[model samples]
Target: MRRAAASVTIVTILLLLTGCWDRLPLRDLQMIDVIGIDQDEKEQGVTVDLIVTSLKGAGKGQGEPIAERTTLKGPSVIEAVGKTEYMDQGPFLAVNTRAFLMSESFASDKPVEEFKFLLHAPYTSINTPVIVYAGKMVELVNNKSSNRQAPIEKLHNFIKSLNSNGVINNISMHEFISSADEPLEDYPLPVVRYHESKFQIEGAMLFHSGRYAGKQITNEQLRMLMFMLGVDQGRQRITGSVSDSKSGLQDITYGFSVKNVRRSVHTQKGTDRLPMVTIRVRLNINVFDIGDNIDTLKPNYAVVMEKLLGKQFEQEAAGMIRTAQQANCDVLGIGKHIKAFHPKLWKSLDWRKDYPNITIAPKFDIQILNTDGFEQFQ
Candidate 1:
């Protein structure tokens, strides 16, 4: 009787543990690797493209191309996602999705509040990479990778490379939301595009108060901004004409593989009227290249290089500021500086109205920390 009672208790426990009746087998569950969001041209709705990876021995390669893509449309993001089943599967699982690609049209449509809500879904992963493309999401996904890597992994690697190079800020869902709510700073999203059968970071999208404000900054402008923001790393090459005493309009190129970038912004109250913003940037550069042989390099090559770099930096800074001001956008975080130093004054002034009138004086101080292989010029 005791043995039977123990057996009965074990059977009851096993039955209780088997309550996960809704659990699908691994073979039955469809693992989604990528989700693409775009705007519907015909209807005022959102279209979702899902790239699903099947586990059924499709091939021997890992992340093999057994992936299937389907498009669904609906009035809202949730509805659009829910309607994804109409394309192929009766019902699909997306908890294993690796990335989300949002089309520029869909991203710039409105407040992006609905998208934010979709991000909070139980199946959505916070760490999943998000990319912004300009064309149809499906087309972007269909673009082939040159390296023979999976499309999703290729996109992930491209974004990661851009972030590591400090070419653009990482614009994840969390970062976007945080910047949108910030009263002093504008949110910048890294833009991706398919070119020449490969993915690239075109530039960054600047937003003011949750809306697309204007055109993106150029690649050079993005580099300069990265330097100003103290995030510049890797190599930056600047080539221009140096008016030599003898060689009239000589082509001189200077390559700086940056070691560090230190910057500071100071606002001064002038008696004349509007406050003046003074920006000082100190750069530690590794001199990697020069135009000609090091033996023929000028004695004042370092000084000339510094001057040329300074001019270039100044021009870039001025262009960035002018473009932002022209677009009625403040992306340089000038408001944050004011709030930090002059809280009372900032409170009294309306940044939106006063941004157009703000004056900025940028100063650059670049020093060559190491000459590396090009030390002959020194």
Candidate 2:
């Protein structure tokens, strides 16, 4: 009798359970893939473009997925998004957004207010890639790949490759949103240009205090910055002349694939009453290429190559540091490190006012781990 009563009670409890009470069917929702934000030609209002993708059959298996383009304009981002309710399908879903593309001008002029909506929205994903493009937001969103893949998909793959190769540190929505409020740390957005039905990542735009600093760095410089910032060491490659040829005809240029890197930042108060920072980087690399000439190899070649590469890297790092200082971009997060480790020093100085004036020195130590001359063939 007790077992029968217990079974009956369990059945009653299961009957009262409510599962997904407010869930909406997929057929009733609009799925957005990419969102583009930009300012109007007059620079007085916001324009939003969305690439909405939805299956035509709605699970009936009748046709291919369809992509619809929609544009909305308003004086602000929130208003533009709100306009969707009146003009388009109800309850839009953006959880699958692959990326957010913003115009250069829009990113430069007061972007914090424009970005607030995305941060507060419940449907948006924080991991979406945020990029700054050179051309019209509409054009970029409407572009189609020759291979029939979505242009935004192609762009996302390109960014992913750059991140995996350690070429550039891809910035996500959460990073961009948080950096705006972080006083010491800044962020970078990969710049894209669409031409001839192709999207190419040109360089990167540096942001300081949530605003574009009117400064851009070349793609080559971006790679060095990635190492300086101590991103994950992927299959990174660097090329430089390690030594001159035996005939003295020209410099022997070689390519090196970085295997490991150890970087450290030291902060001190200089005798001149200024903040001093020293960045030391140690790299372990393998010789990736040695050209057609095998006669260039000599006794103690690895040691000589290490010294030459280290010197060359130090010079390049110094120039990169200067560029960041000049642009007032603390992309290396030196100020953040000082704040965390040296709170007293951080309290005594205004980082924004003194960052450009601070003295920063970069040092590099390169070690060639494998120069067996077989890498060229491999």
Report the number of the highest-lDDT candidate.
2
Model 1: lowest-lDDT 10 consecutive positions:
369-378
Instruction: Kindly give the stretch of ten consecutive residues in candidate 2 with the minimal lDDT sum.
Output: 290-299
Question: Residue-wise lDDT of candidate 2 within 1-378, one digit each (tens)?
Answer: 999999999988886774455655677656666788899877589998877776666776554557777787889877777777676555335434777888998898978767766776756677877888898887876674322265766776877887787777777877777777777657677898878876788888889867887788877667667777766456677775644454342566888777777889999898775688988887877676544334354437667667766776777777777788888999899988998999898888887788899999888777766555534423
Residues 1-378, model 1: lDDT tens digits:
999999999999999988776766555567676778888888988888877776654334533345666667888777877664564554435534676778888777763565566455554555655567867787765763432355666777877777777777676655554555665557566778876667777777777766677667776777777777777654444444444444343566656466678989988876655688878899877565656454344546666667767876888888877777776677777888788889877877778888878888778898865433355222
Q: Among these predicted structures, which one has the highest TM-score?
A: 2
- Give the TM-scores of the predictions, in the order they appear: 0.80, 0.86
**How many clashing pairs does model 2 include?**
0
Q: After superposition, how far is residue 283 of candidate 2 from its true place, in Å?
A: 1.4
Score residue 59 of candidate 2 by CA lDDT. 75
| TM-score for candidate 1 | 0.80
Per-candidate RMSD, Å: 5.1, 3.6
Q: lDDT of all the models against the reference? A: 0.69, 0.74
